[model samples]
Target: MIKRYSKSMKKRDILVIAPQPFFIERGTPIAIDLLVRNLDNFGYSIDILAMPIGVSPNYDRIKIHRSLNYLNAKELKPGFTLKKIILEVGMVIKFITLMSKCNYRVVHAVEESIFWALLFRPVYKYLLVYDMDSSLVEQMVNRFRWLKSIENRLESIESYVCLKSDAVIAVCNSLADKAAKAGSKNIHLLTDVANLREQANIECKEDLNEISQNNKIALYVGNLEAYQGVTLLYEAARLLQQDKVEICIIIIGGSESDVQYYQNKVNGDGLKNLKFLGSRPVGMLEHYLMQADILLSPRIEGSNTPMKVFNYMASARPIIATDLNTHSQILNNERALLVPPSSVAFVNGIKKIIENEDYAQRLGSAAKEYVFREHGIDQFRRRLQIAYDTLK
Candidate 1:
């Protein structure tokens, strides 16, 4: 029986198409790294075809092919950008050439790369695994308001990808539900973990007391997109200016332009409690997180949980996040303070965390425990294994 069962198992060769520049210490890239790392450990040979940017880390049984770089940009951030679209066209051509020559057991498409996988679906018999992080249509509409009229068309494309895929790896429950409704056969709700290998190793060079001027620090990580609720954070800071609490807002992430935009907004509002530390080294992230009295996730939209949320929970810092489904799924009143996406509510939440140290301590303790038990690397690996096993 063992011999017969073993006969069916063949060495797996997977082709992964990462739309974004690979090996970046960002949200989607980090998640992709975890998946690929786990698969490599299971003796799967992975060939990653990604944008010709980002650092490539060494991993056994893995090969990376970077697309031809036409643009001279050093970095490419997430979302729909002109350079990204241009690069994708080149990437798809390379993808086609690779698929024609290589024998892959499965094709793993990350986010927008699904369309490329779909383009070659008719020709290839390989299994398609969609690593669905966010709804492309939703993100497009959110970024470009004019695209709202064509939302249905975009969603139709999204539905097509889900229905065509053999397995859908959703980053959150909401995405899984959407995939289910779109007729996905195998939907795996594998959430993100706090993968901070580099960040954890960095030694702190600055003193927290000197950085915050002895004030209580509240940390906000991630990009400064409108959906990230950076505006709401600034609004809350303005409100906190008049309050008795001495909490300082330290934001870490964003392009120079985004940082300037928010800095001007904060200055115009006459708020002195906010500091925008734009695009710090990844190693510095843990240092700031460690010094923070509270971790802020004022995200106003999106379904998938932000990678920082897991990191925040693991930091044992009391979290103050919007009460929307995006955050409510991971956080509750016991583990975090859930507040509406409003300045007043956010101000109140901050006050609660600052004033009641006992409650905040309990909340932080609970959050850390929850992350260690549910959102660790082992759990992520096991879930990934189950999703792939079903395909076999």
Candidate 2:
């Protein structure tokens, strides 16, 4: 473990409390990585307190500290579960302990971590930054129907976190608007950039070769949550199977159990065109996307855009995404084929892309140009620095 409390320090320390495991190749963690790097570049000493569930990467300007282990589990996936609740409690205890020991200029809290920061605000003389990724209250209610009874309580907490924090850093414009409506005094819209370009050099694995050989391959990259529209993808695959147009649907990234569950469904349905490549290295994302004829974002519900969308756009692949606000904000009819959140609409969108090569080429080119022009990593860095400057 890296040293948590150092006696001497030249720069002002910024305490970052991440509710999830740090250094993981997920959306939130990846955003945290870029934030830490940029803050370090601007000369702020960062101390991150995260769950003891991820491998820490080396950062010159930041130190990663994990909470005390309370559960036998070591990995915490995205979304709410019993394991996540236990780990969150452990994180709260560790965060309080760290705040008691160190003097910080700012407290950068992500997701539920803002609640702990709020609790410590009375004693600590530091500015609070709520890194708003999504509405926690909405997420909880959406994930568990049982939690609907206590939604007002969750919303109250969320409102308090947003209103009380010195500033709110939103991942997308939708989140920024939500923060504004919640009475946040200052809101910074810091959108995410693509990581696909950086991951382009990794060599492709052998299992992917067969899928690449197909006449056309459609790729879906993300966790197989109910909200992600995995069922919709399967239904679309089944629909496409009837046509037998040599189009294969390849899914990448899912837990072992999720993969098995979906794999079983595919086998029972006898869908030969659907294949699952259970969780691969995140760095190989561009490698997989490069061989794809079309990329997919079949999310049925959400406000903030998925991190993969930016990479998909950057990949220069024709995208077939739902016509929800989450996707429509970044993608248009010229950049992607937007269909309603239904299997039939999704399949129709895919068919349109497959049948019209000229349309597909133009859409792909426009999408790549759009991402490169608007969502560059340099844009993220500049906006982040500007937000931090306001705190100073």
Top model by TM-score, which number? 2
Error of 1 at 201 (Å): 1.8
lDDT by residue for model 2 (1-392), tens: 11223324433468888888777778898888878888777666788888888889887657888887788675776888889988888888887777777777788999888887888788877788999988887778888989999888887778878999999999888888878888987899988897576656667665554754545889999988888898999999998888776688899988889999999988999998889989888878888888888999999978889989999999899999999988998899999999999999988988888999999999999999989888888888888877877764
Predicted candidate 1 versus true structure: per-residue lDDT over 1-392, tens digit per residue = 00111111133378888999788878888778878888877767778898888999887567788888988658886798888999998898888878777767788999999987877877977888999999888888988899999999888889989998989999998999999999988899899886555357667676655656789998899998888998898878878888756878889899888899988887887777898878866667777788899999999978888889998998899999999999988899999999989989989998988889999999999999999899888898889888888885
Give each model a TM-score.
Answer: 0.93, 0.94
lDDT of the structure predicted as candidate 1? 0.85
lDDT of each: 0.85, 0.84
Candidate 2 residue 159 C-alpha distance from true site, Å: 2.0
Error in Å for residue 361 of model 1: 1.0
